[model samples]
Each structure stands twice: as structure tokens, then as C-alpha cells.
Target: MEAAPAVLTFSPSSSSPAGPRPCRVLAGPAPRRARALAAPHPPRAVASSRAPLVVSSPPPPPAASGTPATTPAHAKVDRSGRFCSPRAARELALMISYAACLEGADVVRLFDRRISARREPGYVFDKACLLSYNHMSFGGGPLEVGTEEEAEKLTSQNEMDSANEAEVLSAPPKLVYNSFVLRLTRELLVAVASGWNKHVDILDKIIPQTWKDEPVARILELCILHIAMAEMTSKGTPHKVVINEAVDLAKRFCDGGAPRVINGCLRTFVKDHVDNTGTSQAAESKA
Candidate 1:
């Protein structure tokens, strides 16, 4: 028999002679454990060497209690960007006339003095007052600011109005009037001065006995009537407009039934003077 082939028996501890050994996958968790050991640890948050970016927002403003919030009423302005509203001019004229009545001075003269008065030396006007000016006070009312943009707009408008008001009502009255306003005010003052005696006679016939008895107390009301009559007689403004303005002035400056009394008085005056004049003109045209 050929030499018996060399038989090799391998035991667990015996090393087998081979060119390449097959990989033996672990049946249990050994391979998994090895993988776990080899796997990288998840990244951890570390303190940055540089300053970290931070983001923050402003705190919400405290809400007011009780009062309902309302937006501030915008003051009416003309196209000229000045406080030259006819109403404003009327108000100024009324104020001047009232002052003249109190001072017993000429209305135009008083206005001229106020317009020409010099500022005191070393007197600094606080511009910040315009921005910080708040018509509302603590417990006064609530403000309705819908958005940041709206709030900014409102604030800007309010500051502008405050500046205008300050200029108009400053000590010695530094009014920034446009040409129309200046002319209208001067005309109103001139009309008032020229027609004072005539309107006084008319008012004696038209005004109530109570007003007649207390002319000193009714000076403002009388001034309104005088302005309306003078303006109407000039035929520059419509009688209806003049009457309406007079009624509005009375409503603003007078208390209680004064507005109604003024309204009625103006209607009577218009009926007597305006209507009669129109009727006469019509009759003359027909003739």
C-alpha cells in the first residue's frame, strides 16, 4: 500500500496551516460589542472659545386696565404743511379778538405786537418737549398702537403737531401762518374793528336781555357774533359758512345752551340781512 496519506487532526488549540483563514462571525453579542467599542461617541456640546451669538427681544409693554384704547385723533392740516386750516385761522382770530376785548386795545395792534415781540436772551426752547409731549396722563386713557411702524408714525405725527402747537401758542405767539391765513386773519381783525359799532347796534336789537344785562360775561359770545356779521357783510365768505363758523366757535368756547342761542341768533341775522339783500337784488333785477 502506498504510504498512507498523512492524516492531520486539528484540535481547538492546534494551529492549521492555510494560505487564508475564513472569517468567523461571532454568533452572540461579541461582534456587536466590538462594533460598539469601535464606534465613535456622539458629538458633545462644548463651550466656544469665541463669544456665542445671542438673540433677545424687548419685553412687551404693560397693558392698561379699565379704559379702552383709542388712537389719537390726527389734526387736520392743509397742503402747505402749515397750521393754516381755516378753522385754525378762525380760532386765532377769535383768540385775538377776545384778548383785545379784555385788554381794551386794538385787535390788529395787539396781534402785531405779539408777532413782533423779541425772544428773551439766553432763553433756550426745549425741543425735546415736542417729542415727549403726551396729551394723555396716568389713568388718563389707553393708547392703541397696532404695530411698530404705526407707533413710529403716530409718534412722528404727534411730535410734529406738538411743535406746530408750541410755535402757534408760544409766549408772545410765534404763529407760523401761510399767506392765506395771514391775510384772512388780518381781514377778520380789520372787519371786526371796522364793524364793531355797527354790530354792537345790531346785537342790541338781536341779543337776549340776559346777555344784554351781562355784556362783560358775554364778551366772547358777542365777539363771535361780531366776527360773523363782519365777515358776512364783507361778502367774501358765504353767509352760511360764516354762520356755521360762528356757531362752532360758540360751541367750543361757550358753555351749555350758548351754542343753540348762537345758532338761532345767526339764523335770525342771516334771514334779516342776507335774505332781505338777496330778495332786494332779485326785485331790482326784475325791475
Candidate 2:
């Protein structure tokens, strides 16, 4: 049989968030066998289409009752060979939001500048802006940053102090690079801000009851879930991919047993959403 066309692959280093991630430029097409190694974010293929058709989101469902939710068997796979993760985008967003709360900096402008500096893939940048803007809109303030926020503020002040006073005052900040990512990011920010509460309520329904009792205690966990909901509801990402991403984020960042909590809650959330929206056939077909 003729081989599938080869595509260049660049896998990001899972260890270093800031350091330059090594790129592996493979020459041959990937071997097609029983799938084992899988992509982290599987919706990249759908997102890659130049003129993508997004599934319009259904009206937000009412908050949960005691119904048991089922977990999906397998994660959906998007074979686009993307190296970007939503983690960087999320971290940048949180950082910008915290900076806004601490120093009153312009969050949008700061985020735009950071995007240029980071030089992330277009999809990753787009997802991060969408997730962060949605999270910011829902809370209407900076996420709880604790010592991290303080540390960031101190660093900024120190840099400003070290700069030549005349140079700092006279030199205008360089113009932001108007990349496709920036344009999409701005568009997402505005749209999410406009219907903030609507999206927030949708996510609130998806959160587990245990977490719901003391939402403040698990702020970051809830924040990640909110991002996943925004992706599933508005972006038309597969439910399995959304849940897997949420579970993976919890395992990476949240405390022990966090994966179970996130997975269970998201599974139930997906079940409820699918049932209400009558998208089981669509979801299953993807699986």
C-alpha cells in the first residue's frame, strides 16, 4: 500500500515551561498501526481548518442533581502533530490576571505582548486566550495568586528601578506583533466578556458537588474545569478530549487525588451535557 504522506513533527518538552523546547523534525510519515502514543490535545485537526465550522453551543444546562455520571472509555485523537499545550497559555493568562490585580497593568496589552515574546503555535495561543479570558470574565477579577503574585510584582518593580530613568520615560513601548493568534485572542476576550455570566453558570453546573460546597478551597481546579467547559460548549471540541485534558491538567498541577475528582466531575458533566443536548451519537461517533 502507498504510505501516508509524511508531516514534520515537533514535540514540546514536558519539563520546561519557559525554556526553549527541543524540536524533532522527523522525515518519514508516522507509522500507522494500533494507536498507542496519542496527542495531548486532539482537537487540533478541527482547529487547523482555515474555514472551520464550529458547533453552536446549546443553552446552558441547570446545575447537577445526584445522578451518577459515566466515564468515557477512550480519548479522541487529532492527528495534526501539534506540540502546543494549553498550560503555557493558561499560565500566561493567570500571570497577566494576577499582574493586573497587583500592579493595575493593562491585562489585554500585557497578554498580547507576552504572546509575541513566547512565540507559541497559533492553536495553543488561541486556546490559552479563550480559556483565560473566559476564566477572567467568570470571576471578574484576578485569580488568587498568593505569594506568587507578590513575587511577580516585586520582580517588575525591580526591573523598572534598574532601567535608566530617562530611557524608561522617553522610549515608547514597542508595538505588539499583530499575529493571527493576537487577533483571535482579542476576539475571544471580547466575546467571553460580553456574556460572562452565561458561560460561568454553565461551568458551575459541571463542577462536582463536593467542590461546589467550598469552591474557594479548590479555586485552581475549578478554574481548569471552567476552561474545559468553554472548549466543549462553545468550541465544539470532543467531550472525551475535553475531559482528558482536564484530567491531565489536574494530575499535573492539582494535589493528589485531584485527577479522580476532575475526571469524575467532568465525566458527569459530559454525560449531562450530551444527554440534554442529544449529542450522544455525535460524541460516540468521535470516540
- Quick one: best TM-score, which candidate? 1
In terms of lDDT, the poorest run of 10 residues in model 1 is 24-33
TM-score of each: 0.55, 0.37
Question: Mind giving the per-residue lDDT tens digits that candidate 1 earns over 146-239?
Answer: 4555544444454454344444345333434556776787778777666565556567777888776555666667767877877776646777
Q: Against the hidden true structure, what lDDT does model 2 obtain?
A: 0.38
Instruction: Write the residue-wise lDDT of candidate 2 on 1-287 in tens digits.
Output: 97553322222222245642322111111111100011111111111112322211111233379866532112111132111234323332333332322333334554455555643265122211121111111101122223544444433432332232222111211221123323443433333232234434555666566655554445445545545554555555667876876676554445556668778877776776555442433345556
Q: Candidate 1 — which pairs collide?
A: none
Pick the lDDT winner: 1
What ranges in model 1 sit over 4 Å off? Answer: 1-74, 78-81, 122-168, 171-174, 275-287
lDDT of the candidates, in the order given: 0.52, 0.38
Residue-level error in angstroms, candidate 1, position 166: 8.1
